[model samples]
Target: MSDLVTLGQRIRHFRTAAGLTLDQLGDRVGVAGSQLSLMENGRREPRVTLLTSIATELGVTLAELLDTTPPTPRAALEIELERAQRSPHYTGLGLPVVRAGRSMPDDVLESLVGLHRALLERERQAIATPEEARRANTAQRLHMRTLDNYLPDIEELAQQVVRESGHTSGALTHREVGLMAQKLGFELVYVNDLPHSARSVTDLDNGRIYLPPASIPGGHGLRSMALQAIAHRLLGHEVPTSYAEFLRQRLEINYFAAACLMPREQSVAFLSQAKADRNIAVEDFRDAFGVTHEAAALRFTNLATSHLDLTVHFLRVGNDGAVYKAYENDGLRLPVDVTGSTEGQLVCRKWSSRAAFARTNRTTEYYQYTDTPEGTFWESTQIGTSASDEFSITVGVPFADSKWFRGRDTANRHRSTCPDPSCCKRPDGDLAGRWRGKVWTSAKLHAHILSPLPSGTFPGVDDLELYRFLETHAADTEG
Candidate 1:
């Protein structure tokens, strides 16, 4: 059912329950019976002063009269059916909508609502196919590239949250995040045994967000999980019915959480100064915000082009030269499959993203200048480990703009002709001759190649576990 505030429904409920007819109530409120009927039908919005007079006559406050909830379950179903009929899905059917009146049976109303729900679900195209995921990611990436990956609306919302919570500078404290959650009408509860398939579970009925205690390996910190949970509601997200919607929401929440951490105004001012000093670096950004290096690097991409007039690219590549995630508009050619997807595709071995993985000292950031077929680019990479494997996060800019960066003068350099076999993919003449047609290797396949997304209203979550967890907590709350 739609969450629209139904003042008309509430008013109708109260008027009928008070044992008054439209004419009787209208007379007491000094309005015509026809006008009151129109107001109750939601055809005409009543003035606030009029609502006050009506409330007094009904022996209730204006606040109660304007409550968002429908007066009854039947009323809620009526509203949902009304909305569904008006929607384009029903309109496209070119059939006359049956008016839901007091005489309509509950079961009939239910059947129609269920059918409408199914129609909407079918419209989502069931984002379960392999191609759908790649298509969704490709579409979102292209859209992000067009906007330079900055979302000012989300930034504004985060700023309002920060301002209202009394956060000024430095890393956003856990206390401040709690305050923000409170302002959004939620409580963060740390718990053990969050389903293995879940990171966090939001109990909207109880206004509680349940998170696992002790940070999980390769996952973000406590604050990030909390903020992301809050973001799903703050951004007014619905249960995503499609893969595109799911990925978009994921991107948005991550962006919003990062903005809440660094904030746009302060982060830009900090980057502006760094650019002025010609020493812009991701490590410094990470230190200043006390965020993960990957977070800081990703955050920089959000502000780099939009705020600083610098075109940049970011890549998260596995140690095995697989491209995990990437963003670029600065002429760095990334490898992609036919679906315009870079995920799981291989980056050139000679590129800094892969080269940094081979470095002996993994503690320090690896800086390199790679001369690609397109142009010269300078990049800074940091190698990090997770339970799965080692990976690298890199941010790069064109050679000319590299002067404003800290590692512009790095002695490490590489020349490459990626997409050409001889650059790196081809074996040396001696080795090729010795091993030609002599090796037969079987490949170990990743699970994703065969599996579709986890089946549920929300992907990857076990609905039964989520329900039992909520039920247990609800019982405790009642106790």
Candidate 2:
């Protein structure tokens, strides 16, 4: 309801407290009882002169009468009921308007309000399906392509943050990450019992960021996650209301984290010198930054087109050959299903990403040149193991651009006629014909493809558990 309703309610409250009838107040204020009733019901706006007069008669200040709060608990319930009835969902139900009268018990009004709230929460909790998520990802990827996957504004922010953390050279230490957190008015707290749904929790109420110990394994390390969480606050991110916003925040945090590990100005200088020397290598980049092979290769893509005059492609494909992530500005065609999403699509077995898996010596990065319908491209793949599975991180450029990279002369060549079944999807004609009827093997299904994302404030996070953990920690702090 509007301020007029609360004004009238306050006026009525004072008048009743003073034991005056509406007509009596009208006489005292020079207004009609019918008009006072209209104003009280929130159906009419009172004039400034009338409002002043009413406040005077009620023996209350103008500010007191203009308070936006409903004057009483019953009034609050009444207002909520009125709003609930006016809502589209409620009106669409074709139910008669619920008039909360003086005779209506507060319990019934409270129940009605609770029901409406539940309805709204259910609508909010409806997580995006995989198809919707894919569509958002697809749109986000296309938008990233428009900018060549480089966000200069975020890069600048990362540079400022790193410099503030007292990082002048070499890898960013864990202590530096803590110092960074302190500068942001947060303490880094390592705990073993964090909510299973949370990789890291930023307890803004208590000025703490909770994360796993430094032993956070795999290519996505402890520092990266810490930086990414800090980036959220730095970027002014809110809880996303849509899949698109969620994906955008994820992309931004990652970009910020990468920029922090690989600062733009310094990284560009190193890459420029390497380009001039004709010996650019991912291993050297990884060593110089103290980041994982995957992180270094991925960071290269971020700076390649913008700083080095090179276009590149990157992929993180699982041992199962399903592509988890793919980005390219080099016109390398990747397989896609009907949804136009490269994620979860099978990589051609002949490509370096899949072929690197079969190599007996997996100690070092694998390099190869592939001839495809698009063009000849040179790719380097390194194996990285996560808790869930082993995946290959492949970074590649067109044949001409490969001359500047260190792994150009490996002599491992491949040809791929992707999107054609005969290329990699099917076996040889004779072998297929011989085994067609004899073999009846069951196909292994990937269950994740059919599942919807978990429902919560952040996807899959249990909000109640998070709140309870915070409460426990807050109590400890108070103690």
Candidate 3:
């Protein structure tokens, strides 16, 4: 129903519930009873002031009065069918005409409703737009940040899994992970034909974990992926029902996998020793754990605040200068859009994240000391190549904490006044003054940043496929 009609009905309902007649409500809100009756009949639209006054008199919020929920699927189809039957185009088709006030068989109407519902569902699936996907991701990210990118329950579960694996201290190896999988009654199957986008898939009914042959060659990536699959089973995480839940489950699994690779106690000890050293670097930690730089950085954030009593920032910047992922507990201001989203926002050129892209060596680390309006932050960054693209990952600490980090004394210092054009660091002021009203730089659109995570309600799988798999496994167990 239209919002106006919904609001009118709500007003009438609330008026009656309040034990007040139209005349009484109109008197309370200083309006005529006839005007209130017109509004209650939806024959007249109420002005904002009148609506607010009426809502106050009825003891209801404006939103509550104006709330209009979409009809249920069956109701929606019935409404559509009703509208169609009245349409000249539909009546002109010469099919069995459904005239107004004419009764039809219950089964026939139900069958038609079912058919229309299926078609509507398919249309909805096919018409899933990019904007909808962006909204989903934005919501997920907001939730993740709201939880401070940490979950204590997941951490406790990770600790339990680590204890069950019989390895509580030191870096976990692939051999041990394989044995753990076997101990859990799951067979590891390596195949060359799995899709590149798919890292691993677990078949619970068959008790098998499938991995691409490329992921099995003695790297931490294989072990991490395997452990993630194992975590899903061990933690009893069911298929997520929504995008937010999906992202949360994936993050939990990732945390579990990282904890498996670098057990908490051992990592804390290593970080303690590393912190004692005068030159702290993320690469050093990566080498210590035999994992990727990005993985090490992520692990660092997990422990930095809780264990090390340090506030830090982490950034993963794509070659195209869009931020892929960012997390910070420090008072640093990362770039964000008007909606307060950090991902897909362009980094300042003077910042280490964007400046690292200009370096020739993709392997060596680049360090920069930048001064922002917030404060000075010293960041160390390194470029790495993934299967799809090359990106730079950075870990930064506040200037007060920079003394414990390597490259703190580096001469690569740059003052960045970003998100502001008139900052003193910008050299374009004189040029803009010389060529008044002549210079323009078009903003570059990075479409890849807008791409959704994947089709699944989870991060990596299709939700329907995941649900079907779970159902099949449940049936097999019951049989």
Candidate 4:
């Protein structure tokens, strides 16, 4: 019921309970009997002054007569639907505003409610800042780690794709991937002008994949990118319907791509061989598979525990010490923020990931032995460039498994008192006393940090473009 109707009912109940007829109550509140009778019958709405006067004459506070109790679920739903129809975000979708007193079918009402809820959720997600995105990424990484950083379903699909392509039993080359793409009916187009934020774009309608011209000459990066695009098509991943689905599908496609680049059987065999030889080098794995060091590190996590019986940790740390990505199944506890997030946390300078930044030679890999409260670990780090940052990718294993690695005996050792102070690494009373109040870093703001996610049916596409594409495709499908 509307607030006005509820108020009228309350007035009638209270006036009858107080043993007053409509005229008696009207005389006390300076309203005519007929005017008050109309309100009681819900034909007329009462103004606030009359409401207050009636509440006083009825010997109750205005709030008491207003019936401030929480609404029933059905009433709450109706109120939400009303509020949603009036919201700019909802109206901006070109949906009609549902006014009071309109009779809606039950199914239609439920559908609108669901759509309103979804749009509200999308708006909430869209307004997330970079820090929030970082936290979300950290949560997703934790989830991936919880799944042992492996997806057997996606891997199985990838293996099927490889077998069907007749390219079995080894790492795939760029030319081989191209042939596979052709077999799957996709054309690769190298374009000079692609969006800076996008490395590749697939036009499903045209059966074409666009890539930057620089990525055309058959390198590890190009091969990986091409394989990822191909994997998306081959695996039958639909365009994502939501942000969460987008993240999941992206991870699935990435896993499929990695599987394509490093087939499970071959990758397992290589890791087994490396484990037997007691010399696990990421570079050797990268060279064997023609993939980047980062890829090799991530791939190792996929196979380490399940295949090699060794738990490991991997980290991608920027030059300024912010963690870009991190995963650990090992017992070693990584540094985390207040929210238990490892990503975007400042790495302790004593840790290998951060110390690798000090190496003068960016080309050479840096190795370190670190003793933490959790345990001792051996870490190998190499410098790499991402889209807009220079970062160090490090893979570390427990001390028990360190003997199998070549960097096990690195003289670079540090005691890390991370997530804690008063340890040997942090000078007890010396620096604290000397520079107690002397230093403070100024905060810098970047506008892009608060920019909303791209607007469209898909996260990054333009909405109008997506609508047009859908329309054209719909007509084609109908024809």
Candidate 5:
């Protein structure tokens, strides 16, 4: 009785011996006849991609529906501690949500919970209509104002990890510069503000891109401020070019769900078959991508744009869930600021040399970005060091790309090693009483030099419309 209830009675004995009909076997596999009669009746479990499209429309193969009748060699330290506590690296929902009702091994958890309740009842029957979700959010805000269709590739993997770590001289994080910008392909989001019901709106009416943890602190900055307060309650008050094409199709559905959960050439051949004294971790990419240590740190920072010498930076979330979007190289109009750093604090320093400490030691770094030699990793908690407790976050890289040269390189490297030493040289009433840390720890860096002024010409939104009207009047007088 349990070879997953005998593979749901051999998929109802090969769909009634091929005569077919759970609506003709869910219309030859696209799925739905009550989720193929709840996966032929073991009552659901089918998403190893719809059990390979219902075992290629029932001909059969996925190892002949889990190769039947072979159990019994148990206890190798309780089956590797139940395969490392039902690994997805230690549970971000995988092994069919870790074989639900445990004592582990109910016919491989009823054949991975009947292919995860037959692909969530065929994705609740392919949802969509509210006029196809407002015409796919008005054709994704006119394709993000034709922002050259798309290719910062996460600012060329953060300017190829500061030109292959040639060095910017100290202070780093933003999850170790977003795992060297996802080894180098690109995808990252970290928001913390922008929805106290947005004021003059118009990235084509904020289609969607948010970050709001009481507008920015944690449950990961309140899921990027509740995805910009649900794209400012589906664009009502203004800002509409279709709100950057509803955040470029929700950043292309988080870059096609991190390329179908880590498949950029099988996550660069499984992080190049480990061993360079190991470091990839986020729990070894959440047990090879089943996902969630924040979705394996957003699929290892989108494996840094598949490696144009690697780069990715979401130092934190953005587009009004408390803003953050930084990159460096070939889009050089740089900007950085997200300076409060509370929730699960971590503010290590060093973005280049002290031999870039082999790309950040003991890992964990994600400063999204708001300038720094030390003065803007969330205004360097007035540079009190030991990173002002309360789960702090503030790190930096990119030694060049404007702020008159990060305010004259923080006044000529005031005792260099400057990721922030009390705002790099402290003053202005000790950075206005540790500036009570809330610009929701800002971010922005993707800068590699195509025009801050080689005369190819740049500056738009009408030459930064008075610094976007003093950053939209300091995000509407701090919401």
Candidate 6:
């Protein structure tokens, strides 16, 4: 039927838009790749079982398929997902989609499941094309290095924009920065709705970044989202997939923004002066370069860790993706499977409260505490900083790698626990001495530490020195 053919085309279009391929659809629907191709090409009308499989795989509903048109509402995505669960794909694979009659509205849950299924399908398809996987892997590996190579110019331009804008509350809206990029002929397409979270993918050949919204939450996540978006925009394009990787990418963006704000000569001169003083406050830094606190912190930390030879690490409860710790060695080595709070709240405990501790024992360890901001905190004893009521500290050493560490596979050893509720509250406090472990983050890790500037103050310390110190020293001094 022409209608069925048309529907197949629509499904194909949606699949591509969702960043999937035919083989992915097949796996999700539990059909072979060739079978999916036949269905898509309209060689055979999909049976009800196959139709349901296709719907679930695409995260659509049976009604959506029967109607032969894509649904516009978010609710449609849920129905499609439900239909997929009911399809023969699950049965074919001996996997049964749960039938929950008493559960709450299944839309969001179903949609999420559908997304995961689609991703699984895509991964399966990707494995078949070893060459493609290799190419993608190669591309990801080079993306950061190549982007790093071009950062000087990006920093300089960002600086100029800040100076020209003259608005520095340490917060710049995403819309505002996007408009600026647009003025410069860079188009902004937000993928995630978060304001401060944005990314810039580049058409590398044209030297242009296509700014996409970093998350899908929309305006609610606008502020932090915007900073990330602009940071990526500053980089030419092609971002690392995770937060740690993004941090490395942002570091490069910060460098680029700095270079743009202060040309190579001016930046050198500015750094020479600041390096002498070691007192770049967020406001002063913001004034000097047109960027937000978040952006400034990212850049400042990168500069300290990369060029100043200082170690900086940041950890915050919900902002683990924003965490960083600088180190001189390759990275922090800890046991793969060691658990408790060190993996979860190490950042919040250290930076948020500035905790202090003496090594309790030689073995791996962990701890947690709360303070009022005016009392004696953990760091006060060891580092000699004045005590604050708001401070708390927990320390942990790593354990040796083991089978549990390997987590059902020899190659993929576990790094940290899932950050779900009920996870340990203070990971750094429990330092286990044995395992070979590196720090955990959502960003890429760098091996070297920049040398301290001449000033007693760390060369790249920002207005927020207290937090910067914790970020820089946490990993090395933890054990």
lDDT of each: 0.86, 0.86, 0.74, 0.76, 0.37, 0.40
Which runs of model 4 end up more than 4 angstroms from their true locations? 1-135, 168-171, 214-218, 422-441, 444-452, 461-479
User: Candidate 3: how many backbone clashes?
Assistant: 1
Off by over 4 Å in 3: 1-148, 168-170, 214-218, 422-445, 453-479
Error of 5 at 140 (Å): 28
lDDT of 4 by residue, 1-479 (tens): 35655566677778877999999988988889999988864569889899999998989998988884423444445556765676666677786667433276666777778888887777655734456555666678789888788888888887776777777655587677777778778877666655544667777776767676744443777777888888778777765644455667778777888888888888888889988999889988888887888998999899888888888999988877777778998877877867676766667788888888788887867899999989899999999876676888999998888988877778999998776765434666777899888899986433332355675555665656544544654464468
Expressed as tens digits, the lDDT of each residue in 1-479 for candidate 3 is: 24554456678778888999888998899989999887765568999998898888889888777766422333333445654444443456667855212265556666766664564444334332445444555676666555555667767777776777677555677667887789789977776644445678777667778776744554788888889999888878875534545555677789888877877778888888878886678898888878889999998888888887778899999887788888887878888876666778778878888788888776778999989989999999999877777888999989999988888888888887778855533568677699888778897666665555454334545656555544654465478
Query: 95-130, model 5: which lDDT tens digit per residue?
Result: 443323227665665554455445433432332323
18-123: candidate 6 lDDT, tens digit per residue: 6777888777877788876666554567789887777777777767667755434433443455455544444457765653232545565665667757754543
Q: Score candidate 2 by TM-score against the native.
A: 0.77
Cα lDDT tens digits, model 1, 321-403, are: 87778999888988888888887788888889999988999988899999999999999999988778899999999999999
> Which 10-residue window in model 5 sums to the lowest lDDT?
450-459
Ranking by TM-score: 1, 2, 4, 3, 6, 5
Give a tens-digit lDDT track for model 2, residues 1-479.
44555666677777787788889988988989988888877778888898888888878888888888888987877777776677666787899987777788889989988988787567447646778777877888878988998999999999999999889887888888889889889998878889987888999988989888766654347889889889999999987756778889989998999899888988999999999999888888999989988889889999999999999999999899998888999999988878788888899998999999998888888999999999999999998888788899999999999999998889899999988888988889899898888867887665555466677878668889988888888887788
Clash pairs, candidate 2, are: none
Where does candidate 2 stray beyond 4 Å?
Answer: 1-120, 215-220
Instruction: Predict model 3's lDDT versus the native.
Output: 0.74
Specify the highest-TM-score model's number: 1
State the lDDT at 389 in candidate 6: 17
Deviation in Å, model 4, residue 348 alpha carbon? 1.2
Alpha-carbon runs more than 4 Å astray in model 6: 1-121, 124-180, 183-271, 278-294, 305-353, 356-479
Candidate 3 has a TM-score of 0.66
Give the runs in model 5 whose Cα sits over 4 Å from its true position: 1-395, 400-412, 416-479
- Per-prediction TM-score, please? 0.82, 0.77, 0.66, 0.69, 0.21, 0.30
What is every candidate's alpha-carbon RMSD to the true fold? Answer: 4.4, 7.2, 13.9, 16.0, 21.7, 20.9
